[model samples]
Target: MSDLYEKLKRFQQNTPVQKPSPPALVPSSSTSKPLPDQLLKIPGIVRGSQVMEKIQQRDDAKKKFLSTLGVNEVTNPAGKYGYREIKISNRELPITKEDIGGLEIQTISRDASLAVFNANDFLFFDTETTGLAGGTGTTPFLIGIGFFDEDGFRVCQYMMRDYDEEAAVLHDLVKQIGRFPALASYNGKCFDAPILQARFLLNRLRFPITDMPHLDLLFAARRFWKKMLPSCSLSTVESRILGRTREEDISGELIPYVYFDFLRGIRIERMRPVLFHNVEDVVSLAMLAAKICRMVRHPENECRHGWEWFGLGCCLAAAGMWERTFFCLEQAVLEPSLSLEEWIAINKFLSLSYKRLARMKEAVDVWQRMIERGEDVFAMIELAKFHEHTEKKYAEALALTERAILQMRNRQNDVMANGPATVMYEELLHRWNRLLEKRKNP
Candidate 1:
């Protein structure tokens, strides 16, 4: 209800803000903003021939690793066990409900589902692909999977020696999941799953990815951390919620180039650092997932805002957890959107959720007010249909249809060319006229 900008200004004025460090600058006479200092700090950022030398150094490391893990002159136990002394023994960690399940914090212990979250079968995972464009052509150079076993949480990585060894890496991941139940990740839904799936199919590996119940911490980060921080990205979530920070290190963007260096026989030296970066990504996934779970179970401890609840609802909806979705939706609707478009989008989702639960009256009320606040064509059509069918108000329905046409005409008058909206407007006008005639006769 309060002005958002005013509220932000008040909060800033009240809170003792941290004083920023003095920024590094170039010697420029004019009073223009200096170029970023961080840009100058990039290591191994050399492209072309210098970058190729880095790859040769990495390849040399790979060969040394192979020599050290010496071939057995025997077939590996049904799968390629390139360099690791990985054994197929029954070596699960002691993950009882009492030890790992309950957090010391009372709020968190009470909220986590007693039946589902047993702590034994949940694993946190992350990956670094050759490139972000995941196809059969793209390969996962490294995958980091972590869990709390007997010796606290351990990050286990499966790394491909080169592009040629991608199959072995994917096979190990699919095999590892057979030993676990649920998996957790941050934005793994968008990037990790598809990459793994493509790799698996190419290798003739059968992985039951769809069957696995995944908790994408990206969704949870949005829910539990959005109020605490504006960005729900993993690193931000880790910093803001968990009170942790990663030291300046190699980024994921450099990884493909790191591999390309290895491939080109140049970066024989930097593979160690590249592997170090991959290992850190896996470790961060574990830490970030744990941080999110802690916040979700104890919303009070975190001072979460309304957008957190909105995010929570979205997470629950994606997971198909209806009861939890209802709880989150109730919270989100309390804090209506700050802008008309934001309100309409939120209200639209809320109305659809209500509709899913057979709460037609609630859905109708939501759509009606939603249309009044922002009379887009979609809202008008939905409201008009509801008025005609549900309320037996043909006059009201016809009026809404006319309003929709006026909105369309205004939008077209503002159009630059024959875009998608123009075609939709032409179609919508004909549809509205047909609907109005039907209502008039009936």
Candidate 2:
């Protein structure tokens, strides 16, 4: 053991120790900071100066665009971002109070009181949004409100130059919308109002339009023009109902792209058409509201076609005004332009309206007219019921029931072509048996 230990110690002492290799030699130039241009070449590295230059460019573009439109900057004391506003005088618009006067608000808004509010008491509003894909991400970049004052009609538009300015826009809209008692829009109840509410919630602000009486003209317009017009869009109503066609209006789908280009400091001039489109939309909204109000107030004088009378009758029927429904429907059936389908529909409603008002004679006359026009099973059934129960004419009731059964069988054959044909046949057979027993007993 001692000899083995001596040998190991001699081995350790004779071994030579090697020194550590020197560190890699970096060039002196590599130690210095890189130049701005050279650093920019590296991926994922943006120069601070370039960022500031782009921001300055965007600011300059915003200023130039706003200045050209005579927009005034609005400073909010409670918010960091500010918005821009521009007012259009009454002379610039093509509407007057006389055009929109005499509206019965209850006709359009069933909850509203009749004759309490007029055209001046309502505020007409519209919005231009970033996209139709409604969500938190979709923003309303522009808002337009039109109202009547002692002088005349005036339109106020609020615009945000950047996304940060949205809070300020909502802040000011709350104030502006508070002055009006009621609201009117083309489709505000579904689209604009909800979007505004969402924006208000996101901005931590109170929505002023909430709980305000809102009259969405889309419903009324559909009631009046659904059959007459190809579409009930605001643009179609403007051209067809209001007789105003836009010559240079920008397409709505292109508006968001234009706004994005403006934000990126590219072709700021394209925004001009978007602004024009918005202004025209607000103005057209006012005009269309006027037309709709006038039509509801004096449908006899305001309505130009039979379909309008039919629509008015339907509206009145929904409102539970049976007497007015009867009158409008009576007039609707007189026009020769009505198609066979429209004629049959109008007569059906007319008969029901008469029944609601207890004008049985008129109702019977309408049913008779429907029978004369076509083989109407509904009219035959109604007449059979009336004859059997009210007039005590069992023979006539049996005859009408037989006619209705035949009509139903023919319709089923025409439609389904060969089957047991149970469409209304059992009902008719039961009525026939009951009528036969009543006839024999009488």
Task: Please report the TM-score between candidate 1 and the true structure.
Answer: 0.54
Specify the highest-TM-score model's number. 2
- How far residue 413's Cα lies from its native spot in candidate 2, in Å, is 4.5
lDDT of 1 by residue, 119-231 (tens): 55667777877897767777777777776665455666676666656665665667778888777677887888887888788778786566776766565455455555767
Alpha-carbon error at 192 in model 1, in Å?
A: 5.7
**TM-scores of all candidate predictions against the true structure:** 0.54, 0.84
Model 2 bad stretches (over 4 Å): 1-46, 78-95, 98-103, 113-115, 318-323, 413-423
Model 2, 343-432: lDDT tens digits are 998899888878877889999999998999887888999998899999999999999999988788667755365344464677789889
Model 2, position 110, has a per-residue lDDT of 61
| Local distance difference test values of all predictions, in order | 0.63, 0.80
Stretches of candidate 1 off by over 4 Å are 1-117, 127-143, 158-244, 259-273, 288-308, 315-327, 330-339, 355-361, 375-381, 393-395, 414-442
